[model samples]
Target: MSNNGSYSNDRPPSAGETELATDPASGVLFLSDYKKHEDLQQMLDSNKDSLKLEAMKRIIGMIAKGKNASDLFPPVVKNVVSKNIEVKKLVYVYLVRYAEEQQDLALLSISTFQRALKASEFFIPVLLVDPNQLIRASALRVLSSIRVPMIVPIVMLAIKDSASDMSPYVRKTAAHAIPKLYSLDPEQKDELIVVIEKLLSDKTTLVVGSAVMAFEEVCPERIDLIHKNYRKLCNLLVDVDEWGQVIIISMLTRYARTQFADPNADDDGEDSTNKPFYEDEDDIDGEHDPSKEEKIKKTYSLDPDHRLLLRNTKPLLQSRNASVVMSVAQLYHHLAPRSEVHVVAKALIRLLRSHREVQSVVLNCIASVSTKRKGMFEPFLKSFFVRTSDPTHIKLLKLEILTNLATETSISVILREFQTYISSNDKEFVAAAIQAIGRCASSIKEVTDTCLSGLVSLLSNRDHDVVAESVVVIKKLLQTQPSEHREIIIHMAKLVDFINVPQARASILWLLGEYSDRVPKIAPDVLRKMAKSFINEEDIVKLQILNLAVKLYLTNPKQTNLLCQYVFNLAKYDHNYDIRDRARFLKQFIFSENSKLSKHAKKIFLATKPAPVLESRFKGKKRWVPYHTILTPGRLAIMTCLLSLKFLLILL
Candidate 1:
C-alpha cells in the first residue's frame, strides 16, 4: 500500500472485474460471479479510481437486489475516506444501508462520515456548506444516518447550520433530518423544536412543508407553537403541495379546536349545528314564516378563525388535485363554524366535475358530510344528477347523494330526473333509479303519489331487473306509508306475472297479504299462482307465501280457507326446518281460536313500518380523511428504508 495517490500495479482486480457482467438480453450489468469477501478487500486497497468506482457500483447493485453486503463493510468503510466525491457518495450510500444491519462495522465508518461531513477545500467552509446542493444534502443525510448518541451534538449542529442554508433543497433536507436527530436522542426535542419552527417560515413552499412535517413529528401536541403560525399556515395552505396541504390543514384544524374549546359558544351543539336552516313544508305545517327565516340566516355567519380557514380552503375544493380537495373539505367539515360548513359542503359538490375515480371519492365525502348537513347540499341537488357518461359506480354514488339531498323543494325535480334514469337502457342504472324514486317517495309525503305513479309505470318496463327493483322499492314504500299508497296494490297485482325474481315475488306476496282486505279479489289469486310453484319457489318466497296464506285466511276465510289449508299442509311436510316450524305454529295458532292471539298476529302483520330514511353516515364518528405525511408510521418506515437504499446507489 502507498500513502501517495499512486499505487503499485500488482494490486488484484477490483470486485467489479471479478463479479459483475452484462446481460445480453436486457443489456444491464448484474453481479453474476460469486467471489469471496476478500476480493472486495483487494479492490478497495487498489489505487485505481475507475476500478474503485466500478467495484462500488457492483456492490450497490448487489445491495439493491437485497443481498447481504455487510461482509464487504470493512473495505467499503475504507473507501469512504477517498478524495473522489463520487466514490464518497457511493460509500455513504452503502454505509446507510448496512449501518443498522451491520452496526458494529458501521461504528468503524463514523469517523470517515464525520470527515466527509466537514470535508472542504482551504477556502470552502465545510461540506455542509458545499457549493453543490447535492453534496450538502448528501452530507446532512449521511450525518443523520449515524445513530450513536455520542455523535448527536455534531449531527444536530450540522442540521442546524444546513437549515439556514441558502438552498431550499438543502433546507428541506435539514427539515427531514430533525426527526432522525430526535429519534436518536428524544431529549434533544427542545433543542430541535426551535430549528423546526424557524423552517416553517422558509420562503420556499417545499421547505415550509418539510418544516411543518418536522414540527408535527417532534411536538405535535404543542398547540402554542401553532397558535402564532395559524394565520400564516392558512394563507399558505393552498400553495403547499398536496401532501403538505394535508399536514397543514390537519394542524390548523387541531389548533382551531384547541383554541375554540367550545365550538358551540354561539352555535348550538354538534347535532343542532348540522341541522338544515330550511325546513320542509310539512315541518312548518305548510306555512312559511319570514321572520323566522331571517332570524335563522342571521345566526349562521362564520367566526373569525373559521372564516379564515374557510376563505383559504374554499378555493382548494375546486383544485384539480383530489387530495387537496379532500383535505380542505375534511378541514372545513371538522373545524368550520356550523353556519359556514355549508360552504364547504357545496365546494365538495363541485369536485364531482373531476375524473370518474375522483368523482366517486368526492361523492363518498359528500355523502358523509351530508348526513350532518343535508340541507346545505339540498340546493346543489341538480349537480348530483346522473350523467349518462359517468361510470356505473359514479352514477350509483350520484344517485345516493341525490336521494340524501331530497327535500320538499328538491323532491319534484329529483323525481322527474329519476324518471329519465328509470327509462335508461342500462339495467343497473335503471334499477338504482327506480329504487331512488321509491326512497324519495318514502321520505317525503308530498312526493309519495308522484313517485308511486312513476314506479307503477315502470312495471311495464322491458328490463326484468328494472321491474323487479321497482317492485322491491314499491314494497318498501307500501311498508312505510301503507295508507297513502294502497291504491298501487292493483297495479302491483297486475305485474305479478312479470315479477320473476324470488325477492320480487316475496315483496309482492307481502303486499298482497298486508293489503288483502283492500284487494281481496286479486290477493287470493296471486297467492294461489305463487302456490303452483310451491315446491320450486325460493325459501324467501315460500316464507312470504306462508305468511300471506295465513293472513288471507284470516282476512278472507271463505275464499281462501281451502287454499290456505293446502299450502299449509305442503309447507308442514317441507324439507326446510324453518318453513316446517312456521307452518306448525300457524296451524296451532289458527286451530286454537285464541281471539287475543289472533288480534295480536293481525296487528303485528298490519303495523306500519317506519319510513325508509337514510341513517347518519358519520354520526358519533370522527370526521376522518386519509392523508399521507412523513410523520405517519408506515411512511416513516418506508422513508427510512428507501433513504438507506438510495444513499447506497448514489454514494457507494
Candidate 2:
C-alpha cells in the first residue's frame, strides 16, 4: 500500500481479452488466458459430472462476489442459460442475487441489464411454464426475485395463456404474478382485481393464497373499485389456508376499523338512530378524561367521531383468527382514544398478559394507538406498572411499546415509570426502559434532557436493532431540538455502526443527515466517517441526503457551503435522474441565495410571463375552408323570393 493508502485504479481486461486465434487451448477468441475460463467451459461441456458441478459452483461464487471477472459474465450467462437444467438453476440464482445484493451491478447500463433480464425469460417459462411441475415451481420462486417491471407483461400473458395448465403450482404461480405486476402500476389495479376475483374462486389452496395476498396488498388502494365484489373477497378470507386467512382478515378488519372510526353521520345524532351499525356511545371502561385536551385533539383529528368506530370494533376484538384480532386491536389502540379506549386497551392487556405468539403484534398495536391518548394510555401504563416485575417477553414488549408511544404529554409519566423500574436493577428491564426513553427523546423537552444518560447507556447494545433504534431516536431529538440536544447529538456522532441488513444503511445515513449540524461539535469526524457509507448507500438515501442538504441550506445558507457543493457535484454526475433532479431542484435554493443570480432570476421570473402561445399561432393563420362547400339551396331560394317581393312592393 502507498503512503496515501489509495486503492488502485487499473481497468480490468475487457470481455474480449482473448482472441480465438491466439489461444491454442480452447481456440475461443474471446476467452482470457490468465483466467482459463475457456478450460472450465470445455470441462463442463465434456459431460464430466463431478468436474462440471465443481466448476459451476466456483463460477457461481465468482459471479456472486462479482470477481474482476467482467469478461466472464456475458459468455457465462449465454453458455449456462441454455445448458443442463441444474446449471440453469444455479446461474439464475447467481444473477438474481447479483441484482438484489450487489450494488456495483447497478452501474451497468439499463439496456445491458434489460438484456440479461430478457435472457432470464427463457428460464422463466421453463421454471414457471414448463411441463415439469418442480422446475416450473422453482422458476416462479426465482421470478419473484427478479424485481424488474418489463417482465410484468410477459408474466401477465403467461397467466392468461396457461389458464388450463395441468400443474396447480403453475396456475398458482401465474396468479401470484398479477399483483406483482400491478404493484408496478397502480392503474393496473383494476385489471388485477379482475384477475384475483377469478382466482379467488379457484379450488386450489395455492391459488387462493396467492389471490388473497394480492387483494390485501392492492385493495387498500383499490377498495372503492372492489366494493361491488366485496362479498367474494370477504368469503375467501375463511379459506382453510393459514396465510390466506391471515392476509384477508388483516385487510377486512383494517378497512372495517377505519370506516367505523370515521362514519359520516348527521349532527345532533340523527344519523346514529337510523344506522344501527354506527352506534355513538361511551367506551366500556368509562375512564375517559377531558383534562387531556391534546389527547382528544390528536385523536379526533384522526377520526372525528370515534363513537361510531368504537361501537363497530367489538366484533373485531372477538375475531377468531389471531391476525384479525391483532389488527383490530392495533387499529383501535391507535385510533380509539375516548374513555371507551379501555375496551381495546384491556383486550391488548389480556392478549399480552396471556403470553401468546401474537403478543408482540398486540404490544406494538397498543403503542401505536395509545400514542396521543393520555387518559386512554393511563390504563395501559397502569397495567405495565403492575406487570413490571413479571419476567416475560410480554412484559419486555409492553415496556418497549410504551417507550415508543410516549408523546410530550405522556413522557413525564413514562420517565417516572422508568425511575421506578430502575430499582429492580434487572439489566434487560433497564435496557428496555432506556431504549424506549431514547425513542421519545425529541418528544418532550424534559424527555430530551432525561434521555441523554439512558441513550449513553444503550450505545453499547450488542443487538444492532437496539443500537440503530437508539441512534434513530437520538437523530430525531437532535433534529427536533438542535440547540439543547447538542451533547446527546454529539455523543451519537462518534458511533461508527455498520448494520449488515439491506436497505438499512440509507436510514442510518438519514440519521447522520439529521444530526449533521452537530457534526462540527459532537463529532468533527462525522463526514469523514460517513464518506464511504454515503457512496455505498442506495439511491433512496442519496436522495434523502440531497433533500436534507436542501433543507439545511434553506435554514442556514452560510453553514452549508460544503454541503451545497457536494449536492451540485452529485446532481451533475450521479448515475440516476432521480438524484439528478433532486440535486438540480436543490441547486435553485443555493442559486437564489446568490445576489447576482437573484437579480437575473427575478428578471427572468418576471419576464417569462404566461403567453397565449396557441392564440398567437392562430393570429395570422387562415380559418379552415370545407373541401366541398354547400350552397344552402333552400335558404338561397327563400332569400330570392323575399327580395323579389320587396322589389315589387317598392315599385308599387
Candidate 3:
C-alpha cells in the first residue's frame, strides 16, 4: 500500500512497499484508489498493520488540513483493538480530532480507551508507567481528551495517578489536565481544585507554576485556598519563568487587596479590634499629639504577609525582564503602602537604562506615581534629564517628568536643565523646553522673573520654530505677569520681521493689541505690515489680526483708524462666515450710538486671562492597572489540541 492508503496491486504491498509514488506531470502523489471513503475503508480493514497504519495517517492528515473525514470514523474506530502500538496511536489521533464533531460515534471508543489505559505488558502498566515519560504523558493526555462524562471517572483516576508520578514532566502535564476536566464538566471543579492545591506544594517549579495557572483558570474566586501557601509561593516567585512570575504577581496582588481592608477607611465597618486610634482635636502651641503620632504609625505599617511579599518583590525591580519589572511596579503601586511606593518608583527609574521601548513605559509609570505622591521623586530629580542619545518619544517623556517634579527646592536645577535643552538643534525639543519653562514660571512665583528672562533671550534663535515657540510662551507669560514683564514688548517688536509662521505672527499681533498702550509707536506698524499680507494669511492669523485691529482702533484711534477700517472692509466681504460676523459685530460695537453695549464688549475681551498650569494627561483619572494572564481561553484550546497530538505521536 502507498502512503495515500491505496493498494497498487490486488494483494497488500510487502514491508518494502513504503515508498510513495508521484505523478509525472504535476509532481504530486496520485492517490487514485483513496480518493473516496470506500478506498480508505478497505485499507483500514486489511490484515496488514502497515496498510492500516498508512490509511490512518492519511485520514488524520486530511482532517488536520480541514477535510471532511467524518465518514471514516467508524472504520478508524475498528482498528482501536489492533495489537500494533503504532497503528493504535494513529487511530487514537483520528478519534480525538473528530470526537466532538461526531460525539455519538465517539462513545464507541470509550471501552477500548479504558482497556488501553489499563493495558499491561509483562505485569507492568505499559501505558501509565512506561519507561518513556512522553509515552506516559501522552496516554494520560488522550484519555483526558475524551469529553464524554461517562469516562470522567476513568480520566479522573488516570489524572490523579499521573499527578504523583516520579517524572516532573508527567506532573506538569497532570496540572494542565485539571482545567480541561473542570471545563468539560463544571461539577468536577471542586474535586479538581483539591488535586490542583496538592500540586502547588510540589517541589518542582515547573509543576508549581502549571498548578497555579490551573488554579487561576479553574478557581480564581477561591483565593483563600492560596493563603496557606502564600509564603511558599512568594519565596518561589523569582525562580519561576518570566510568564509564571506575572501570574504569581497578579495572584498575590488580588490576595493582598482581599486580605487588607481599604486603606482609606479609618474604620472598615468592622469590629473595634480592627480600628486604629485617631485624634479628634488639633495640637496646641506646636506640642506633639500622641494620638496623631499613633495614627501615622499605624497607617504606614503592614502585616507580616504583605511585608514579606513586598520584600520578595523588591529584587524583581532589577530583573532583566521588562514584563516582570512592570508587573512588580504595578503590584506595589496598587496594593503597597503609600510610604513604600518610593521603592517601586526608584525601581522603575532603574529600568530606564534598558531599551527605548522599556524606557518609554517606565517613564510613563514614573510620571503617574510622581503626580499622585508629590515630592516622592524630588531627591532623584536629575535622573530624568534628557540624554542626547535618547529617541524623540523618550526625550519628550523625560521632559514631562522634569516639569512634574519641579518645585521650590528643585526649580533652579530643572531650570538650568531647560536652558541647555532650549539651545538644542531639535526644534520640537526646544519648543517643549520653552513651554516647560513657562509652566514653571506660572506655577512658582519666585521663578517667574528668571524663567521669563530665559524665554526672552530665546527670541533671538535662528530657527523659526524655536522663535515661534518662544513667542507663544511669552504670550502666556504676559497674560499672567503683564505688570512686571512689560519690557518683553520691545523685544517682541524687534522680531516682527523674523516671525513668518502664522501662529507666531498671531501671537505677536495679539500681544501688541493687548499691550498697545505700552508700545504705541511700534504696534501700528506691526498691524499695518500684517494687513498687507491679510489676504494670504491662514484663518487663525487673520482672526487674531482682526481682533488686534479692533483693540488698536479702540485704544489709539487717532493713528490707526484707517488700518482698522481696511481690516474690517477686507473681513466684511470675506468668504468665512465667522470672520464676516465678527467684522459686523465689531463695527457695530465700536461705531454704534449704543455706548452701553460697546463698553460691555470692550470690558469682556480685555479681562485678565487665566494662567496655564502644567497638568498631566492622566490628571483627575484613575490609576492604571496592568493586565496579567495565566492562560487565555484561546491558548488553553491550543494547548489541549497539541497535547492530544503528542499522545498520538508517542504511540508511533
RMSD of 3: 14.8
Alpha-carbon deviation at 204 in model 1, angstroms: 7.0
Query: How does residue 356 of candidate 2 score in lDDT?
Result: 56
Each model's total of backbone clashes: 8, 10, 0
| Total clashes for model 1 | 8
TM-score of 1: 0.69
* Best lDDT among the predictions, by candidate number: 3
In the range 1-652, model 3's lDDT, one tens digit per residue, is: 3434234445545687664422223312234444677867977888887667667777765665577888887778777667778776777677767666677777776654544334342112246666767667766776667677777776777788888899988998898888888888889887888888788878677787888888899999887678667777878887887777888888888888887654444555433232322222322124456585467456654444555677788889887788898999888877776667777667776787888888888888777776777667787787899989887778888888888888898899899898889778777888888888887887788988888788787788777888898899889888876766667887887787778888888888888888877888888998898889888888888898888888887778888888898988999888889888878877866767555556565665666667666576645456455455446898889889899688546533
Query: After best superposition, candidate 1 residue 95: deviation in angstroms?
Result: 5.7
- Model 2, 1-652: lDDT tens digits are 1111110123333567531112122223222332567655654454444444545565665554456444444444443334367666665565556543433442232223233233444322433445567566545555544555655555554555444467777667766666656665567666666766666566665676666676666665655544443444444444435556556555655655545544322234333222323244433334545565356454343332334334444555655556656655655544554445566655556665554566666665555555444455564566655264465666676675566456677677877787566445466666566555655664455656667666656566676555655565555455554666566554554555555433344544555455455454322244434434566656776776565555455445576667567656855677888788767755764565553433343233223223111111212223465645544888678888899688556534
Residue 638 alpha-carbon offset, candidate 3, angstroms: 49
Deviation (Å) of 644 in candidate 2? 83
Please identify model 2 stretches exceeding 4 Å from their true place. 1-40, 48-52, 62-88, 98-128, 140-153, 162-168, 179-193, 200-205, 212-220, 228-232, 235-246, 257-325, 331-364, 371-383, 386-652
Ranking by lDDT: 3, 1, 2
Candidate 1 error regions (>4 Å): 1-26, 30-136, 139-171, 174-207, 217-219, 235-242, 261-320, 334-353, 370-385, 405-413, 423-426, 553-569, 577-600, 614-652
**Taking the tens digit of each residue's C-alpha lDDT, what string does model 1 give over 1-652?**
3322222234544656553222223314253553445555666777876557766876777777777888888788877657778887898798788765666776776665544333342112256756778878977787688777766777778888888888998999999999989988999999898898788767678787888889989999877776656666777777888888877777777777766534445535433232322232122123446575566446653344454566777887777767777887777777765665676665676677677777888887787666667888887777887878888888887887788788898777887788778767787888777777877776787878777777787778777888788889888777766766667888788777767888888888888887787887999898888788898888999999998988887777888888888998899889999999889877754545653445456555566556556343444345455565326888788888898688446533
Give lDDT per model, in order.
0.73, 0.53, 0.75
Deviating ranges (above 4 Å) for candidate 3 = 1-204, 207-232, 262-299, 374-376, 517-525, 553-562, 575-599, 618-652
User: Which structure among the candidates has the greatest TM-score?
Assistant: 1
